[model samples]
Target: MQRWKINLSVLWLGCFLVSAGMTMITPFLSLYLQEDLGVEGEHNIALWAGLIFASNFITSFFFQPLWGKLSDRYGRKMMLLRSGFGMSIVMVLMGFAAAPWQLLLLRMLNGVISGYIPAAVSLVSASTPKERMGFALGTVQSGSIAGTILGPLLGGLMADHFGYRPIFYITGGLLFLASTLSWIMVKEKFDKKAAALSAKTSMLGNLKKLMRIPQLPALFSVTFLIQFAMLSPMALIPLFVARLHGTSEDLAFWSGFVSAATGLSNMIAAPLLGKLSDRIGSFRILVICLLGAGIMFVPQAFASSVPELLVYRFLLGCFIGGLTPTVNSLIRRYTPDSSVSQAFGFNSSSLALGNMIGPITGGALSGLIGIEGIFIVSAASLLLTSLWTYRSLRRAGMGAEGRTG
Candidate 1:
């Protein structure tokens, strides 16, 4: 196999492992606090769980660009390993946490070290042929979605049989195995001397330089809005599902199914849409998917039955699946080769920023506008973003059909 192909394959697995490891422990955290850590009272468990969960993204939002700069200076592969190993160790420590604060601190540290996915993106973008970049990024994205879909199911099963703390240990072991595989199999053509020469700009200097690229800021906004819109409705889905389901029995199952439905379709659509974008141009794909996803959300808001919502969620996934890979491809297309990692790092920050704030906003809005209103707001936001992205590309003189900037 060619070196780039080999690297893509391993990095895909690395992404899967990293995403799975992060998510697997998340579903059980509340239970862990209540059962294992002996947290009493509903309010306390909720507060502790929310804080511990958001702490990771809060730190991740601030730290991703720093790692991106380091990756550009050192090597993406090294950054990936650093994140993989760092997260693995931190995850294990969570299992040993005797108190909630320990777990919160560890989660914060885990967030600070979380860069495997972005680093993998940087590596693939740096190594893959430009002609195949869309497909490669899409494939990698599918791996992450697959992990996201499977992680909760697997974690729930393990937690039932093996208990919560052991789930952390198992997640850590899986991360270690993934990193070990990358260490042995993934090869980079990175030149340290050249990277050192290119990375002399301060992190702020790099950010300023990348922002001067006309299409990039819009691309970054689209990245942020994509995540923000999707995640905003995420935490409220179970209540929405319950309202539609009209029964408590199997409510959990239906909620899980609805959540996974989007990921399942997304995993299938990402690579397919990615390949399509390579032929038709990523800019066009971005606009269409954004519109498609936005339209799909409208139907979800009106869904009267669980099955209706599930179907809508699945359709939404098909469009949402295309957004991240296309955005990443576009980011790579617009960015200078020397600052690609830094650009992706900033893009990752946008994603982390959305992840951190989306749920809070959603929860806040759920009371004022109600759950259905949140979906309308999300849909509207996406449609506006699509228009903004279209105008941004037009002003930058990128034709809708242009394959490269």
Candidate 2:
């Protein structure tokens, strides 16, 4: 790889490793909680499982703004190092966890310390010229999406074969290499003036600056919706498969397949849409992708079989995949160079908050309503977001017209 390409690729791979490792644990966490930790009955296991999973995102949400600010201060490379090192240590510690509380605590700690994607986004944003940003960020985002596919398949196999213990060790091992490569490969043109511009403790000040940017409020709402829609399926996918597919073994295979399918589609679509957005504009691309995702969601609820479900997921993933990169591109357009990391940080926080909410809420909705309700909820959210995005673009078009007139 070219030096810059290697820097982006390896850092993205590091993100993929950590994300894959963390996500790979999800389908099995409750089972592990009850069986390994010896929780008192199903109810306690259920509650603890929720806490364990939610804690990571909650911690991420609390720290993302801070991490984003720190990335601005310390350098993107420093943030990746911080994330890789932190996740690696915590992931290994989790393998040694003796109790539910211990595992949950470590997961939370993992969240607080992890900073890879934010740092990577900052690096890409700062490095890529404005015209090429959509393609650059989209290509980078695809790695995380690719990890979503590979992590679960490989992780499921690892969990089934070597057991959960090995999963943590393997994840930690990958992370160690990722961290090492990031340290060696990724370099920023560190400016003494940029270093001096760092406000290490002024995360709130940075957030305030981001908040004042034009259309940020609307963009933030759209961000929340995009995440909320994506994570609804993610939160209870394993369980959904169990409920919808034939057997537990069937669930495992189908669950892994669906996760990977989305990643595959996303891997293909994100960059293409992002490149198209570069030609068209982020706002227009966002609407197109969001609406396409919404249309794809309809078939998911009505799929008669596992194969059908997979097909629908693959198609939907094509569109849903592009939504995130489009949003990132739009954010970059509005953000000043000084606070780019902070803006991405808030965007990261939105996803974390949604992940924390989406799973628990989806699970609850599945229980109280039906499995199909998840699709309905996700589709509705995406539809609303698509409309908002379209309106925003139309208004901007008129704004240009008025400026000329």
Candidate 3:
């Protein structure tokens, strides 16, 4: 196999391992806190869970750019190892935690060290042929999406059988294995002198230079809005499922299905759309996916039954799946080779920013405007962002031409 193909395959597994480990604790965190850590009250357990969950993103959001800068100066491989190994250790320690505070601190530390996905992206983007970038990124993205979709189900099963602490230990062991595979298999044609020179440039200087790229800011906003809109309805999915299903006995199963439905379609659609983008234009795919996703959201808001909502969500996933790969492909096209890692790092920060805000905003919208309102707000946000992206592309003269200006 070709070197780029080899790297993509290995990194795909790495992405899946890291993403699954990160989310594997999701279904049982509250239960673990109450049972093992001795959190006394329901309110406190909920509060601790929220804090622990948000802590990772909060620290990750601020530190990703720093890691990106280092990746450019050193190599993406090193960053990947650092994140994978560091997270593995932290996850293991979480299993040993005797108190909620200890777990929270460890979770925060995990955030500070997190950058495996962005580093993998930077590594693949730097190595893949420009003509194949969209397809490669789309394929890579499917790995993470698949892991996320399966993590909760796996976690719930493992928690029921092996218990919570063993789940963490197993996840940590998987992370270690993933990192070891990358260390042995992946390769990068890095130039040390180029990295040193790039490192000499100030972070502010790099930012200023990157800001001059005509379509970069718009692309970044597209990433943020895509994440924000996609995640806004997630926190309330169970409640919404209950509303649609009434007192059905299969409510838990149906709710889990509704939650996983979008990711399932997204996993199937990402690579196909990516290949199409490689042939036609990522810009065209971006516009269509954004608009299509926005339109799909409206039907979801109005769905009268669980089946109706599931259908709409699956359709939305088909469009939404393409958004990130297209955005990453655009970012790689527009960014300088020497600074692509930093560029992706900043983009990763934007994603983390969305992760931080999306859940809070979703919860707030659910309380203030009701569950359907969250879908409407998300749809409207995506629609407006699509318009903004369209105008931005037109003004930059990249409309349909797909030139890497």
- For model 2, residues 1-405, the per-residue Cα lDDT tens digits are 545566667767876787687778766676577567887644455556666777788888888767766666667778888888878888988999989899989988998897787688778777776787777787777677667778777766666677677788888988898889888877777575767765445667777877776666567767787877877656455555555676655444456677678878887787687777667667666777889888888788887777788888889878976777777776777778877756876777777787787666665566555657788888888988888766764564523421332
State each candidate's clash count: 0, 0, 0
Instruction: Count clashing residue pairs in model 3.
Output: 0
Model 2 residue 245 CA deviation (Å) reads 3.3
Which runs in model 3 stand beyond 4 Å of their true positions? 1-12, 26-52, 71-78, 93-104, 120-142, 159-166, 180-199, 242-256, 275-280, 302-306, 333-339, 400-405
Better of 1 and 2 by lDDT: 1
Q: Residue by residue across 45-64, what tens digits does model 1's lDDT show?
A: 54565566667899988887
TM, every model: 0.78, 0.81, 0.77
> What's the ranking of the predictions by TM-score, best on top?
2, 1, 3
Cand. 2 TM to true fold: 0.81
By TM-score, is 1 or 2 better? 2
The lDDT values for all models are 0.81, 0.73, 0.82
Candidate numbers sorted by lDDT from highest down = 3, 1, 2
TM-score of 3: 0.77
